[model samples]
Target: MWHIWTLDDWEKNIDLERSGHRCGLRLRFDKEVDSEVRRACKEFAVFLRREYFFPIRVVIYVKARERIIAMDGDKCCGIFWCMPDDYTIEPYIRLAAGDYEKLCKKWGKDSALTNILLCMAHELTHYFQWINSIKLTPIGKERQATNYADYVLEDYAETREHP
Candidate 1:
């Protein structure tokens, strides 16, 4: 069943950086999620904050099939929204937990989390572009995001293997 959540429904919120009055890394997970999955996601968010800077919030919806539709009206794994009022509003990301689970079953937990992390990284790339005023065509943006995600995952693997 689809359970809509308000800002108050955030259970996995974290402040990545708080230099002054800026908010950071507001993460939310559905109440029905497994503890293991929740832990992994939280840890990954912290890792992302450390590795890069972008996006102020992330919401992961549980297997609510209809609730996580993209702008094209098709079911999507994730989306990153860039607010119009850049100075007053910050970007945020949303991910589908169902897709994460499917990847886990097919690729094992760590690999699946890696995939989900790639999705998050892709969204993050958009935020990076938005903040830096980097302009690109829609196709160029997607290609860049995909390349960035792959670069991130490769770097992560190297860190794990060497460190």
Candidate 2:
């Protein structure tokens, strides 16, 4: 099992000086998960930086799979890949057939920003797990991924309420 506190530690270690207004988050989930998922994540990351003063660049890659596999014998689902230094948003946008102008029109600037922040936080949490040498069976990793997604959604809602 991976430690959840890894995310908390990353949050604390953020270097505000290097953080920027834009994030290049990538998701590696099923392509069928909804085209908006990537958009939401990028927007939320932007929101976190703008509102909380923790600027960051989040790049996401959403990979499509025929079926989710379990890391172990457990019932977890979904997998994510992330890197701290590789914050490039262009590739992901191309994969998802998305553009900035369309997102801004659909979600509004503020909402889109917040969505990116949320996604970045979630993906970064996974990166933390990887960096900490946390290992999860296939099933366990899948479960963690599912839970992480839910947590991100909840966090986005909370942020919106208070922001």
Candidate 3:
């Protein structure tokens, strides 16, 4: 199972108040997976909260999926589920173990890490859009999420390169 942590866990274990007024829940990966991906996810979470002004708790689940490989072939990279609340919606993100391994093998660890961050950002954007009352069809919503992720990743890269 993936390393699962909830908001309550973060609240009790982590310094929530110091976490930039936003709380994050992190899921740890197994030792076999590259640790850099985990670090990037956390960093991206902070970036999302600090830059986007979205107070969010990022829950990282590492190796939590029942199937390590992608059932739907290699086309599907990962999955993200969002539950919208009145104030905020929780996002659940997962990457297929097979996909992760395949990407790492093909693109190296750094590229795989970047991909995960992009996917997470995309999923989170969808939740935010829903909360903000953006009317969209299912496909449209997915497209919007992808677009948001692309935009954020581009922005993040530019900022990092210059700063």
Taking all chains together, each candidate's TM-score versus the true structure is 0.71, 0.39, 0.62
Better of 1 and 3 by TM-score: 1
Model 1 C-alpha lDDT per residue in residues 1-163, reported as the tens digit of each score:
3211112222233233442225446577777655666676676667666765443443434332323677888776678776643434555677766555666678887876676667766776766666545568999988988988787667666656321
lDDT of 2 by residue, 25-111 (tens): 333444454456555555555654453321233344443322233345332222344453443322121122233345568977655
Which candidate wins on TM-score?
1
Q: Which pairs clash in model 3?
A: 2-64, 23-57, 24-57, 24-58, 25-58, 25-59, 26-60, 27-60
| Whole-model lDDT values for every prediction | 0.59, 0.45, 0.56
Clash pairs, candidate 1, are: none
Error of 1 at 28 (Å): 1.2
Runs of candidate 3 with Cα error greater than 4 angstroms are 1-33, 55-76, 82-91, 95-98, 161-163
Worst 10 residues of 2 by lDDT: 88-97
lDDT of 2 at 140: 78
Off by over 4 Å in 2: 1-39, 48-58, 61-79, 82-125, 161-163
The digit string of per-residue lDDT tens for model 3 on 1-163 reads 3111111222332243564445444565766555566567667666765665333554545553323334445344455555544334455556544356667789887687677777666656654564355668989878877877787788787756321
